[model samples]
Target: MPDLLVEHHGVQVLVCSADGATIATEQDALDHLVGAAFQGAELVAVPAGRFDDRFYDLSSGVAGAILQKLANYRVRLAVVGDISHHMGTGTALRDLVREANRGRDIWFVTDLNELTTRLAPRP
Candidate 1:
């Protein structure tokens, strides 16, 4: 299936295909951001696997660059998938995930279900 625009809890999101081209550079990430914005998406949800492995490595600076670009445009991002392997690699990754999850701009979730839950409206 192709990337699609979906609504959850009244917010429009661009859900990227898991099998799509890997985002390995800042330009690749910018492409997705522009596409999502064109589709009127308030947020973009990309399968964690779609991101290059370097993204999970803080020293590589890929994640920070991509996320900063998105945040600069006020576009929220949700990385969806199981990243336990990456998390187990180091405390930096684990801490980053923990911190990102606590913010409204970025989130690291296990799956779409968890993404949905996080986007759900609360009383």
Candidate 2:
């Protein structure tokens, strides 16, 4: 499915529907960041399952690399879906998810609604 453009807190966000695509590598992350920019979107919401399993592995550094790329491009990222399973495996991974969710640049949310709420302008 095609990406849906939505507005939140006056920001344009590209919400990617599950398309059977896996964002497993740095290249995939880069491609999405560029695509988001091309679509005039400041943020991109991707389903968690779209990411490769290695992304949740801290030693693999996949998640960190992808996040770095997004940050470099000044593109916000929202990873939506259930990640409780991945989080259960390690404290490091869980810590990473927690830290990312606490920041504005990257967020790990349970659903699209939560993503939108997190992106909403705060008073």
Q: Per-residue alpha-carbon lDDT of model 1 for 21-49, expressed as tens digits?
A: 89878788878665556688998999999
Top-TM-score candidate index: 1
- Give candidate 2's error at residue 33 in angstroms: 3.4
Residue-wise C-alpha lDDT for candidate 2, range 1-123, written one tens digit per residue = 887888887888888878757888889887765565568888888888889999989899998898888888888888889988887776998888888888888888999888878877788
lDDT of 2 at 105: 81
Q: What is the lDDT of residue 5 in candidate 2?
A: 89
RMSD of each: 1.0, 1.3
Worst lDDT 10-window in candidate 1 = 29-38
Candidate 2 clash pair list: none
Segments in model 1 whose C-alpha atoms lie over 4 Å from true places: none
For model 1 the local lDDT of residue 89 reads 73
